[model samples]
Target chain A: MSDNSNNNAYWAANMRIIKIFLVIWFICSFGFGILLRPLLSGIAVGGTDLGFWFAQQGSILVFLVLIFAYASRMNKLDREHGVDE
Target chain B: MDQFTLNLLIVGATFALYIGIAIWARAGTTSEFYAAGRGVNPVMNGMATGADWMSAASFISMAGIIAFGGYDTSAYLMGWTGGYVLLAMLLAPYLRKFGKYTVPEFIGDRFYSGSARMVAVICLIVASVTYVIGQMTGVGVAFSRFLEVSNATGLYIGAGIVFLYAVLGGMKGITYTQVAQYVVLIIAYTIPAVFISLQLTGNPIPALGLFSEHTASGQPLLTTLEGLLSDLGFATYTEQHDTTLNMFLFTVSLMIGTAGLPHVIVRFFTVPTVKDARSSAGWALVFIALLYLTAPAVGAMARLNLITTFYPNGTTEAPLSLEEIQNNEALDWVRNWEKTGLLKFDDKNGDGNIAYVANGEANELTVNRDIIVLANPEIAQLPGWVIALVAAGGLAAALSTAAGLLMAIASAVSHDLIKGQLNPNISEKGELLAARIAMGVAIAVATYLGLNPPGFAAQTVALAFGLAAASIFPALMMGIFSKRINNKGAVAGMVAGLIVTIVYIFLHKGWFFIPGTNSFTDADPLLLSIKSTSFGAVGALVNFIVAYLVSNATDDVPADVQELVESIRIPRGAGSAVDH
Candidate 1:
């Protein structure tokens, strides 16, 4: 394949990964912290509802995991696509 | 040693360690001075970034804010940490690939205009200088409280210490010293928290302690806290009271602002490869999480501890008498902070008792929540050394962040504004000298403002984030993602975002934070849907839309630049990119 086609394919793959990770990110912060909070109300942690946990602590943990997961996976993808430095 | 002496000794030793590191790792070249020669290890860099990112506001005041604000203030915790996700995903790796020394360099190159770079440098300096003032003020407050010095004297001392290290070592020294500061601060923060956690919840881990049962109440920690707060006429700790729209916008604004901060973006430039940049962000988040996760627990538990101390029997009983507060040496911490005017209690209603009921009507005395974290060890009847360590930790947090911000300001002035754009013929030695001069001037300005802070430390921090979000975030995002965004569009977006955010902040706050000139309250912001805190995200959206609309009206990006944007979009060919 030509470099232009290769570049197009690579950009497409990168966006795909970013989109997936972002979905999880949205779920944890917006979903768990706000919209889905009522659903999580029954699942209490400590004295507070699960939603509060996500708001203060749980979402932050998930954010760290999401970033690391995206980064390492992208590194592997880079090598696979002959884009590794 | 006496308690005071012991406190002084520990704090002094930590400062000595920082100075020693500054001496050993001093930067030898511009590259080392600005970006640590792009060879910092991921884990070490992460720790250093953690120190750089977690300012005094995070270490000393964040928990206190959460304790008082309850569920409404979860925005601070979420807004701050959530931005890292945006950083790792949208900004860090690509900027690393650009292989630039400063944020303005990337902006200038991508726009193919020196004018664009100059605009970015102005934004960078304005945002960074405003941010550093908060750190310097925090340092002064911490020093005055612990060292028994006046605020002005403390400011000078703080400025001197920052000058010694930041001027000598640059980014290279700052990075290593930050790692040491991180250890000192985290240990100082967690030890007292662990003691309190174990005492309250029978849990050694504070994060878990927040979810565990309160030993005295025999109820889960959060439930007990909520019940106690309501009983004391305060809002429930877990219930949201702020407007939902405001919350959403505020979170988004903070996320973009974090992504846009020049000091933070520049940290990625220290990594050798794009992969390292990506991984280092993960590591940095991990280090930050160590503090971020512990903060709410500390906030909740400290509130509980303080309430218990006041109502020794329970909220059903009479509050602590004024005599108890005034005469009890165990409560010396309260007296200590009161002297600084950060903590004050007025005997409103002429009541003889010190009742800390939180209802607007029932609460007679105004209490600054910033005192809670600073006074926690003392409230818990912990050893005097613990109190001293907390003081040192607060100072470390402030100074580390100040150093980082000063370095960012200096590099933008000397490297991007002077060498890259204005004086291309300047020698490297001359440039380095210019950088040093800029750092010194930045510190002096910060110290001067810190001696007479216009607002509280945390409020000033919000302004910094707002500026970064409005100006830098939009430009960088457009630079890499939108091929059609011309230099005109990018510059226009930044200026629009910047002016709107700054004017809004000025209107709500003072004009340029000069005090006594604000025309609006935060409750009645300029736009119906926008709070000043949340306007950064709004400005960012406006930036995107304006850039797009304007760019479409103009000619398309040159083909070569289109290809460059495409190259940056992919993860491919990232690992081999050299830092320099």
Candidate 2:
């Protein structure tokens, strides 16, 4: 029963992490990149605005970081939960 | 050597390399054939995934789309790469831990319903088959332009080569060859980009060079582009021309669609462990981003180069006359493309000079966007070898993706439909034979479709993403994340998603794309500015909604099924993937 409770706790923590990352993913790609692009138009990035940079190049960079961050965090989480394969 | 010979030599060398790699990595068993025996390294799998994921559209048409569409085309850039974040965090790891040979197998066991599994297979086949048709067409175009053959002959040769490698080597063969392909394609893509960027901006890294100062004009690239465009009576290059609603939904659709694709999902299955699956997606995105990052630069710089080629001084100079275009030796590339009827320069006013406007009358220069990337080297006056390398790169992009999609289709038939359902009593040897036979048949059907495409393959590729997003993504996410979704609810949700999306697509794109069959045009869409291509997000939302509401009315999922979900979520005891 204790093992079951501990397992639930671990899974809940994982979900929390997934949810947090997903929100970041949304903000980087859709929020900053597209919807709020006009607000960032005044701030120059390279020759273009911040939003255009975020859309074409910056979003992809953030996506790469997000994946690696999730992977490293999950691996540590797996160890903590004693679920390491 | 002459230019033709040089082109042939470079392209043939790449072909030999691929065939050699395929021969060296033959599959010996069903495990090796289907999942590459689950022994692939994470980075290698990532490289292969990168090659497999960047299909014909990304290679052949994306730059052209970006060249014309400008600021509006960010949906493709962000949507395509953004999906990997979802795949790594939401899908790949858990699906890898599920340790199945096929996605439908996971769906079957999770839903505990053969019918639901069959629906998943159907959706997979529909998406994959449409995607392969586009690749085959791209292969034909690349071949015809470079090898100096007819599109038909080129397609035949392309089909034969794909059949040789894909049928003989299976997943193991495809994996290693895809790695080689990634190298060939990236080098082929970036070399020309570096040259063009260096020519235009002093920076060699194309991504940074896009916004950097233009060396020729001594102005910011984007600012110069906007000036040149408005000078030509076109829209400013930096403004949002399309509705934010359409752009937002389109990006969401492509993101979910990328994560939901069966071929891409199966690549993760080839990696050895769940941890590898997580890391491999990151590496795959890095490789994919290498080209994707350069594409906009290639597009923008190519367009600027094109304008300068016409003027030689700047936009203020008179456009090249029809006689100059026809007789000038510098215009040979334009003439060559014109012979294919894809490029046209009409002196609409008979002023001799060409006029290209973003919209509204008095337009004379009509260039197919797909030809821009292919014509970039020639437009920039790069050497013959660079042009030849682009041919090989385009073929690599199309063929690698076609093989991957064909593999997914074959496995769905052999593993999911035949072995999983119809012939559970089949022997292992028989299953392997079936897989090979299925691959051959898929290639043949794809070739036929390529020869006589339904005219909507490109549009349908967007629909493929819609279907995958609407159906597969929701079900798979729910399977692991929520045990409350019963089999009945999944079926209901999938059906609803499929029907709504297909109906929406057909209404706007035409039923089967028979011109007069469309109920409404994209310009005057029935659903308040939502294009058929952008309907996938709506479809996905409907899938989730219908799934939750229906599942609430049904009995709860079984106890052991709940346990199965829990086991997949934790990522433990994952050794070799096993069958139910």
**Candidate 2 per-residue C-alpha lDDT over B333-407 given as tens digits, one digit per residue, 9 for 90 to 100:** 888777655577878787877866665567788886667888899999998899889888988888888877887
Q: Candidate 2: list runs displaced more than 4 Å.
A: B27-37, B149-157, B168-174, B359-361, B426-460, B578-580
Cα lDDT, all candidates: 0.81, 0.82
Clashes of each: 5, 0
Cα error of candidate 1 at position B295, Å: 0.3
For each candidate, what's the DockQ? 0.72, 0.86
Please give the lDDT score for candidate 2: 0.82
Interface RMSD of 1: 1.7
Question: Please, what are the lDDT tens digits per residue for candidate 1 over residues B2-97?
Answer: 666877898889988987886667635544644552566789999998998999778877888887777777878888898999899889988887
Q: Residue B232 of model 1: what lDDT?
A: 86
TM-score of each: 0.95, 0.95
